[model samples]
Target: MTSQTDGTAPAEEFMDKVFGDYVGANAIFMAAIGDRLGLFKDLAAAGPATSVELAERTRLAERYLREWLDGMAAAGYLTFDANGGRYAMPADHVPVLAEESGTMFMGAAFFDYSTKFGESFHALLEAFRSGEGVRQELYGQEAAEAIERFTAPWFEHQLVPVWLPLMPEVRTTLEVGARVCDVGCGQGRALIKLAQAFPHCELVGLDRYEPAIQAATENARQAGVGDRVRFEMHDGAAGLPGPFDVITTFDVLHDSADPAGLLRAIHDGLKPSGRYVCVDINCADRSQDNVGPMGTVLYGLSLAYCLPVSLARGGAGLGTCGLPEGRLRAMALEAGFAEVRRLPVDDPFNNVYELSL
Candidate 1:
């Protein structure tokens, strides 16, 4: 191969990288299919089975199951026994693929990319050409549900026990029956978890998305926290229903149409002694500093969803990696916050910031 740009065979190296990405993409699509069909869960539960046996168990077509099982085995997502003519999901893979409540579960990511991002590809391409953006509503309920599924495990397992304890003062406030609101509260998982943990606290969840609000309300009811928690469709950029003891925004600000306005609203909404907990993508202000797997995922998501969604509404377009600690601190200070501290919570994909008046 002819060398281009660099002395070493650049074309060959680049093509190798491209092929690797292609294989990864195919694996993701396959994973999405398996997740949608409950193939992984069945395989994990039923143990090794021939395609026919698996088909009988899942009530799916044998021919399709055979192809899918072969693909999964090829991708190393499942083990294949040639002599036995059987396939099985590994024990360790069960937590990631089959168990929704497991902390390491990642089944929803496939749906998020294949269903949500794939559906919006043409719109995103148009936005790229016109320097405009795709609207959030265009992604539909699939995106909302995928996001809920992706974040629910974290909220269920970590929010009350792991994350909240980092902010002892806020925990104490909740314990004392403080009024709290979670902005951009998709499906009300966080607030529902909080309600279950701190029974005395009054919790409310707000999101601009109608589908998400509806889901949140239903989910709260299903969790039996309907009376303790309320879900409302409210845009924080316009204002917040306040005098709150504590407020939270999880993975929200970067996708805001008016982040600064929202920050101001949060500041004004809080009581004098209130605290604001801001959870956003873990990122650095400078582009050069962001060079890793998480950074790649965040930046890709920014292009596919976050940036465009915000820009569609005449927003600052602070894509996924835009909000680092320094940027948030400055914005919070300008929005009248007296203190903005990055909490020492150790999370790979998110940063926790505590803002106080």
Candidate 2:
């Protein structure tokens, strides 16, 4: 290590932060590998075991498994028992790494997000130089599938029970068999859940990505809601068929290149008495104001996915963390919305709004 001379405190501090980030990056990737290979799940289910034992259990190569298990141990993701010559995931950490459908499941998903960023790094570098955004398609199928797994827990647990109940009127409308549309509905998990929850509501899922739309269609068919829920590969800025009783855009509004135009389309497509529901990154308007862990994650995600895709389309780039409530309300108002009411709910990542025309 180089010795720090006088007046080098700032430089030393910066270098230390960089070194820490480097380690963190490697650890995240290793965690993702463990998740992908079902190593964590096996550990959680089978208790402490040697790398050789784990290799046999998972039918994977022992040499790679040994190093991965060591990495997990060094990262404190797993406990090393020298006395027994075995390694195990801590019981408390099991849910966070292995239970994809549960609330505590976050580590694996973040790893997926990190992997996507790495995949797009080259194009993102070009976009940074050109001042243009990376195209959404460049993110590719693996990233898309990873994102679905990442968001599944929230859509599965919170969307219907916690969020929908916040909008009693809209919930009642859906309960009574209203027409519903989900804009930018990536893989259609939300639509499928909604269909299951409210079978009478006619549902439509829309996205510009054909691959995502295809995945959504397949998911709907598998979920046995294909009859009631249909998907379309349509751009939101082009406007939509009219008079949907309830419309939703979850964690997607800020990703739009023309959020105002999309909002206008949403407003115009809704029935006079219809409701528009959306969830976007919960952030302060100013970049400097976005602080703490969640804010850091949001900004990282912005650079990785949201900001680049909007730029790819040569549209308004409202980087993920840029859309604070004030800006959101203004955009909605400009789109002829009568009200932009923030729904009362507690969430770490998203702010829910109920818009009316």
Candidate 1's TM-score: 0.96
List ranges where model 1 is wrong by over 4 Å. Answer: 1-8
For model 1, the local distance difference test gives 0.88
- Judge candidate 2 against the unseen true structure and give its global Cα lDDT, from 0 to 1: 0.89
**Model 2: how far residue 348 lies from native, Å:** 1.7
Give Cα-based local distance difference scores for all models. Answer: 0.88, 0.89
Candidate 2 — which pairs collide?
A: none
Candidate 1 C-alpha lDDT tens digits along 1-357: 465657778767888999998898888888888998899899888899999999899999999989988998999999988899999898989999999867888888554555567788899999989988898888888887788887777787877888888898998999989999999998898998889889998999999998888888998899999999998999987888988999999999988989999999999999999999999888888999898777788888789788999999988999999888889988999999999988787888889888899
Query: Candidate 2: lDDT of 114?
Result: 83
The estimated TM-scores of all candidates read 0.96, 0.96
Residue 84, model 1: lDDT of: 96
User: Tens digit of lDDT per residue, candidate 2, span 62-96?
Assistant: 99999999998899999999999999888799889
Cα misplacement distance, residue 252 of candidate 2 (Å) = 1.1
True-structure RMSD, every candidate: 1.9, 1.9
